[model samples]
Target chain A: MIAYRPREVIIEAESWKDPATAGILRNLPGIPRRTVADAGRISASRDTLILARYRGKFLKQCQGSGAEMCCNYFTASYAWNCHFECTYCVLQSYLSGSAIVICTNIEDFLEEIGRTLGRNPDRFFRIGTGELADSLALDPITGYSRRVVPFFASLPNGILELKTKSDQVANLEGLGHGGRTVVSWSMNSRRIRRSEEGGSSTLEERLAAADRCRRWGYRLGFHFDPIVHYDGWEEEYRDVVRQIFSVVDPGDVAWISLGALRFTPHLRERLIERHPGSRLPWGEFVPGHHGKLRYFRLVREEIYRKMNAWISDCAPGVEVYLCMESRLVWERSLGVAVRDAGHLSDRLDAAATGGA
Target chain B: MNITDMPIRDIDTANEECRISGELEAPALVRSLRDIGQLNPVVLLERGGRRIIVCGFRRIHAARTLGRESVPARVLGPADFSPLHPLEFALRDNLAFRPLEPLERARALDKLEEAGLLPETIVRVYLPLLGLPPRADILESQLLVARARPGLHHCLAGGILTQQSVEALARMPPESQDRFALLMERIRLSASLQRQVLGLLRDLAAGDGASWGAPLDGEEVGAILDDPSLSPAAKGEGLHEALYRRRHPRLTRARARFRERERALGLPGAIRLAAHPYFETADIRVEFSAPDAARFRFLAGELERAARGADLETLFEVDE
Candidate 1:
């Protein structure tokens, strides 16, 4: 994938005091930079990069935290937008303005995270930065992965997962991550990647990047979330599973998450306007109790059962979990009764620690 | 601004650069003029050696229809209206009296752009003033609505099309827009049904700009539309059902099978068994309304009888 080059950069006047801000700017050598008193008010386009100080808590509960059977995962949003223009992306409707906003106060974010982990030494927290943006898509310019990998390396009670669909893994090498960071990718069939997920790395490129992370002594993860249900999907998805097993060791894979394609009605309207050609939202969709449009219950059960079986065939006894699915679905598909959010979290935490 | 009795002939009514409304003839205004006379003065701009209307196109049209040579009006010359376009004056004049319709709003926005206002300014400053959100996409859609075919304008004037449907209508080719307008006239669609039919049409296309054929294309639909025995409302419903069937053939077929199986069970009239929405789940719902305890007991016995029968298994089985 081509590296992101912002047409323009807007910096919050107060953000210049942080050293990470200068480092980020140094990477974007001659881009036009404008300093504003308030970066929040400036309307941003996709080509404009806004460097602002994140005033709110840098760490937040994942948006899917409200699910009945959540993984009890958390999100640390050092950035607020993405560079990829995936047609089914929720951010197109969730976020305003087209600009990719990056929080420059990384040091403050790390300080608060360290304190939060220190307070809960006995609990395991699985945090990621991919909820709002592709975790490593902007890593080349921001070098955020380099700063984040080592920070989690020193901690014992937490694991950081960098989920991405980009191949920007150069900065991740030669870092003392200490086996704490799990660099993952959002995998889909090659057809969906080419038609729906614009600018995202190809499946081959993503698995190759995952292999590189494995060789770097860091753990790896793969998420099959938002798996589209279509004709000939079984063969393509099964092939993807086989390719993933060929590239990296399942022992080093911390967790593999499976979720069916879903979105809100509001996001569907945005898709109609922004990506008019996309037919991903057209299906036998029913509104879930949580306000997201999902495939039929039986349809979801079939997808999860097949995907779980395929993954198990290649790498049996690996950590496989669901993201924001219902307890009934888990029971019917995975055949594991996950009682609630806390129970599921415990299961994932054990997986994160390699069956500790 | 100056008020005067200018000749109707002196004003260039043929030109429409400053007009903010699409209404051409106002019979009601003509009646009002005949009954009580003009209550307010029309606004006009003196430009290019003739007077151009800034506001009150309907009022002027009514006066002309009533055979009046002139009417009382407010005329703004070059010095009086500066730092503002004539379209704003027309917009303010109408907005002060009443809200602009969807077509008028579109025209006002198009005129504002034609008057040299930047798109950003229009989105930020004018959209809210016109009671719309400051979104460029909204602006673009509105512009499409404003410039849509004349037949669509007639449909829009009838006040049946929703905002989504209006945009969809505008995006179609001119011939399609006219046929869609005619079909809409033959049927009265509720807001929800309108979206469903149009959404199905939109989804049928594998990509954008692909033709959905015609709304009255097939022989079955054409017969339904042409059938004199069917009322307009029934025609609308028939069109909706046909489109829904096309959009979800598998689901519709499965539903027919479920209904057939349900009828074969021969439960009492008081009891009803229904499948889940979209037949998404294997669980079937049993509903029975009872006014008294005795009725409830009888219904319960009937329900148990049905459950013990083997046909209950078929009711629960979904056609995958």
Candidate 2:
């Protein structure tokens, strides 16, 4: 993965007083810092970093369209935007600007999560920090996992899942996460990783990192998301599944997810403009619920069923789930469907915690 | 600049000084010239010992039609103006009266380029002045339309073929363009329909890795064109539907299966069931009309019974 080096840094007046902010600034010594007033003039040059104090509630539900079944996971947004440029990233259309933003108020974000978890002590919470940005991409510089991993370790019922495509797991090596942190990687076939996922870590690098995390007393997870379908996809994905099981023990693996490529209608034009030669947008699609364009139902079913079969063959008794798919699709592909979002959430919680 | 009266015969209208050629007479402008004398003087430049009218071709033509021997003119030496000044002046002067047709805009851009202006320069300077997007693709499309054959140019200029349609047509080979022109002339499709048909054709050709003329060679397309009983609108509708079905076979099959399931359910006329689009969700909407409470209860009971049938379950199945 490409390292993030902000050409310019903007700090809010309030955030400038925080010790974490000062440490971050001191780590990248000699980089200039500006106040929030200069935000309009900073030009958002793709390398600019804005460390503003986020005022909203940091812990929120993933914005899932009710048109499909949601995994019902909570998102802890400490950052926005990513350094790596995946051709089909949703942020290209969701974000209004291109600058990378990291909230310097880590204490306040943790306090909100602690309060929410304390209030619901009886219920298990599966919270993740990778919804809006790569969870561990900037951890080497910020050392945020040092703070967040221990925080979740102290929790009685909360699990923190640090998901990323980068192999930046060095900071997480010595953290006493008490089997609470599930270090996962967003993976795809080598063909897709080479063409679509520019500036991301290689598949072998990510699997090695996952093995290292497992050795460090952390449960491991894998997400085969945005699974692009192309010629010879069966062999491509089967090889990926085989490689995954060969490295890590199935007992240490918590959950594996499969999500086919899906995007909103407007992202098509943006993908074409940003990545001119991308063949991802030329697939036959139909307008799905919530105005998103999805592959034909048969294509999606075939991909999902084949992937589920391959994963099951490689690692028996490993729980495989579909991300943001419909009830009918779950039934047709995996032969099972949780009743609702809450049921799905419970199932994932049980899988992650090993039915504690 | 000197104001003089140059004879209509001496002003060389046949040279390459002006590339804009068409009906130069506007009846309203002619009537205005007759009611009140000429308001703007014609702009002329001296080149190769011949005076050429640069700005006011229409005004000069109007004067000639009025049987006037000479008209008021502003004369300039060739050194006083740059090569782009004539096209710039003509484009700017005519823009004030009315919007330029697509062909006219294309020709103006082409003429500017032919005068040694870079595409970037035209995109940055002239596109905004002519109310076009300042993008290289737009300039390329306009130049393509300008360089097409005269019949296609006429169609483009007359608003029969839209900008998008012409751009799609411009991507095809000349032979394909000729065939498409003949089809378009026979069908006389509206501009929006023309764009839709051409867009579908382009997608089909790209998906098949064949030429744009491949889809047009089908017997069904030819029969639609040859059928005398169908109206032009009907023919266009049939052709577009056929092309769409061919382009998206999976979606077409899914919809057909859904419709078949819908018909097999044998629901009442007052009730309707619509499957969720693309089967992205397993949702089925049941709509019905009831005039009174008794009828509403009856319809509700009928729906409750119909919902228990296996056919209704099949209707909501994901086929794609």
Candidate 3:
């Protein structure tokens, strides 16, 4: 994939004191640069990169709508959007003229994580930075992984996950992660990886990166999220599952998550208006909880059931969970009954904290 | 504004400098002028030694229809349009009595551009004054709606067609637009169903690689609408269902299979069983209404027997 280089960089004046700003300027040498008193006062496009000090809560609860069994996941949004224009991305609806904003206050974000862990020593938090933007897509330019990785290594209560689809693990090499950071990839079938996710890394590049991280002594994760179904989806996805287990040892993996394609009716309209040629969001959609559209429950179950069987066929006793599914689907497909959010959270916390 | 008696023959009716009205055929105004005469003065603009009707295209047409050679008129110089643009002047005059129709607003905006106002100024200043969101897309769609075929005028004005639907209908090939207008004339769809019908037709057409109106030309769809035994409402419903079934054959087949299984159970007429919403879930909904205790006991017994029946097990298999 071609690398993304911003045409212009607009930095907020308040971020001048932050060290990340200096690193960003040193990285993008000779690029056009302009400093504004407030990034929010100016309008920027996707071509422009705005660096501001995000004053909002850097650590927020994973907006997994409470209508379903949530995985007690927390999201830290150091950035606002991604570079790849996936056809089914929920951020497409959040298309404000304010382009991709990167918060330069990295120290403040790390301190917030530290304070939360210090406040609740008994609780194990599985915090991720990949909710709004890919965690490592901009790592080469931003060099955020070098700072965030070793910080989590010192904190014994929480584990950090930097999920991405790009094959940019060069920056992650030789970081003192101390087995506290889990580098995960958003996995998909080969056809979808080629057609829908147009600008990300290839299937080969992603698997090769996962193996590289696995050999580096970091726990790996694979999320077959938004697993699109088509005529030969079963065969293709089965091959993808087989390929993942072949490269890495099961013990080196953290967890595998499965989520079917889902969106809201509003996002469906926006997807059509923005990307008219993509038929990914149009299908047999039944209104799930919270007014979000999802695949027919039976279709979702069929997918999860087949996927779980395929994964179990390769490696037994691996921890696999559904991302935003109901309790009924969990029981029917994975044979794991989730009573509520806490039930699923405890199960995932064990996996993240290296328990049974 | 000063009123005067001006000869209608000298009025430059051909120069529609500010003709914001969509239709000039005013039957009620003509009838009123025939009975009680003109109550309002037609506003005219003086330009190049010619008089142009700025806000009274319909009034002038009505007076002409009544065979009145001269009529009461308010003649103004071009500078008199002032603080407000000529299009705004005409729009406010029309707005004083009733809301401007969709085509009128579109035409008025078009004329505002012609009246030396920037597109940005029209969007920022005039759009909100006209009760529209200050959006370029809304303006573009309204302009497309204004240029729709004359066959779609009554439907557009009668609220049968929304701005998006009009835009959709207008963007079709001229022949397809004619076919859809003819189809719309025969069957009336509800507000909720019109959007679904348009979408289903577009999807079916795209999937089949045919014209946008190709499905309406089919014999089966035509026969459903032309059925003499069906009421208009039933025709609309039948057309929607037929389009939905064709567009989603897998879902239709699954529902038909479920219906077949439901019929074979031989449950009482009062009891009803339905699959989960869109068959997305494993749970089913069963509801029965009973008036008396005896009737309730009978329904309970019937439900239990049917629940244990052999065909009932097959109903749970909702997959294709």
Candidate 4:
């Protein structure tokens, strides 16, 4: 049993350099070292175990305006800074340090989610908790999705997209996913996974997990968001698509989202400072309509055209969409533009609900 | 005025220990001299009892330009063997006021060698400090072309080249020097064949040249390439598509997918667009109005005309 304190005495931790977790600690801003007693509980444990719980607010939703498309999904929790140190993560900019934040109030989070879904039962909300941390990443320590998915299954109007880059789906093996919850994986080409994304599951491992989830009557989705630009990228992406279709049926997938590499300006600086060798952050970019720097519109269209074409060939009926792109981009690249944000939401809802 | 303040006798050019004491005279050199003093002193050497300059010719010119009566100097032995002594000194002197190209350096060296210097002597005395092959290729190539004929030299220097120009040069009864110059110019051949012709041309001139390559035979090109009137940017775009198609023949099915969609929608004939580098890899999802395509086509057209009129001058200018 652990002692719990809501408000603790504040102490500044100057610097933390533990050999066991030195790799992750070095890249963060210097945190002054100090100790807090029973003021607020300081949970201490082994290097692997994460301390967390159900929270007050589970879904952090961002709704799009009518003119823009709403591939805008929700991030449930703020904590869980990744241990993987993937060069592409947006967390490096958002969080001050690598220390994973595990919310101790899980039941409270689920209750809030229950109220939101209850209030807007008719309006479809596609939400997920794995935005900051890999959704199921800290499963061993927190047993998060194990606790949340069952509750999510009870809610019929909304679907939970538990996205991850981890092969830790063993926790969900016997759960009644009921094809209601979508298990999505953010995938990259094998070379990218090997070079840029550290501590993430290999392409084959993620594919195997996706295959397993499909066999167990779960709806699966793949996100090629942050599809990095590199030499020989076309063949590499095509090979991943081939591997995907080979393992799971098109019907098993709710949708596939293609997004070119993009991030907030602050995130770009953090990525470069932390991962100096990362070249993806420094590609040809211009400020887009949304004010975030994006790859030139032409570049986005090119990536969309190639990947959409490959997906259309491999899995003929799977719903293919762009994540957080302009209507012009959609029309120029795919010739399919949602007339409005509502229509975009309707299409995703339809795909998720109709999936086997 | 004190007589002692005046400079004494002009130093003997052939004297190894002789020194000159006046500052450089060129306005820029004088200004620099006033601000920074002389950083590099002139070097002179004696050969056959005549003063020969081993290096610092431009410094002498600058000092002369600045109206200085005499310049400082160190006389070297005829057999001096300092690595990079001559070329380095020569480069520093010539490059002080104006940036000099390798070709121009070759020309300068050519004149000096013609005045009775040996390449072997230059190599032994100056080439050692030029470092490995990476650092030496440009200088060596320049020297090699300089020894060749003017046509070959211009060819290596990226003079106007076309199939016709190449054939004309090839057929010109082989003069050894001309043949050598043409040989150097043909280095651009491999790049052109890979369809990097424009890039090679851009590299040739300091600015993007207004035009390059074989002059378009309007009829032959009309039959093969896209309609030039539609847009040069579009045409330039077509080149990328052509290259992509050439590289990945598998994208044919992908093209078919787009064609089928266009046909089903009852849209007009699809506009030929450039293939992006990632065209075959990622999903292309687009939604836009008719006005967008038209606007994009017009922009592409303007870019194409600019591309068509490209010269080494515009291509190599300091980009904004």
Give lDDT tens digits, candidate 1, residues A1-356. 65689999999999999888999999898999989999988887889999999988877788788877888788999987787888888888788777999999999989989999999898788999998889999988889888898999899988898999998899999999877788889999888888888998999899888888888887888999789988888999999999999988889898899988899999987887777667687766777756888877777888889999999999998888887777877888899988789888988887776776
- lDDT order, best first, reads 1, 3, 2, 4
Candidate No. with top DockQ: 2
lDDT of 2 by residue, A223-282 (tens): 998898778889998999999999998999889999888899789768866876676876
- The residue-by-residue lDDT of candidate 4 on A1-356, one tens digit each, is 01111121122231122221232222222533333322124443212223334324567765333226766566687346776667877776666444555555565677787888899878777887777778877665456667677887888777888888888787787887655689999988988888778878888888888988887778999999789876799999999999999999998899898988877777776675677556666455555545566766666788899999999999987898887777767877787867866777778888887632
Native-to-model Cα distance after best TM-score fit, residue A319 in candidate 3, in Å = 2.9
B-chain TM-score of model 3: 0.89
Question: How high is the lDDT of residue B97 in model 2?
Answer: 74
- Model 2, CA-based lDDT: 0.82
Which lDDT tens digits does candidate 2 get at residues B146-210? 77766676667666677677767766678887877777676767777786788678667766667
TM-score of chain B of each: 0.90, 0.81, 0.89, 0.36
Q: Tell me each candidate's TM-score.
A: 0.82, 0.81, 0.89, 0.49
Q: Model 4 chain B, poorest ten-residue lDDT window?
A: B1-10
Kindly report which residue stretches of model 2 are placed more than 4 angstroms away from their true locations once superposed. A1-16, A21-37, A45-52, A119-123, B1-6, B15-48, B59-153, B164-183, B186-232, B260-274, B281-320
Q: List, in order, the clash count of every candidate structure.
A: 0, 2, 1, 67
- List DockQ for all candidates: 0.26, 0.44, 0.39, 0.02
